[model samples]
Target: MGNEKETPEERRERMRQRELSNPSSSGHGSNLSDLVGGLGWKGTGLLILLIITGFVVYSLATGN
Candidate 1:
């Protein structure tokens, strides 16, 4: 989308071809690391914190 050399149609086609080539994965990579990696190292920490928070919340809520 940022390429100045390509027209809108070209961009659309390029995107279409990219999607066609990797139909199983979305732009976020369809994986936890890929999704968090886009946000850099902080995202990893945030994800871990979220997981821990969820576990703690669950444990507290269920007396587990």
Candidate 2:
């Protein structure tokens, strides 16, 4: 009986308050960690592509 339904706005506000109360729990860390942690398949593919491109460029520069 004590538990009442919360409206959408109320629920959103409650969640916002909870997030504000615990800043660390928000999952935002250092910029580098955030960038690395947020990487997905696309980022991984791009990293691979960059590595291959770098190898090719290095070999070309070395005439190898």
- Give the per-residue lDDT digits (tens) of candidate 2, residues 1-64: 4227887888889889997798788677556555656897689678779989999999999999
Best by TM-score: 1
Candidate no. 1 TM-score: 0.50
In model 1, what is the error at residue 56, expressed in angstroms?
Answer: 0.5
Q: What TM-score, over all chains together, does every model reach?
A: 0.50, 0.42
Give the C-alpha lDDT of model 1: 0.83
Worst 10 residues of 1 by lDDT: 25-34
Which lDDT value does model 2 have at 9? 84
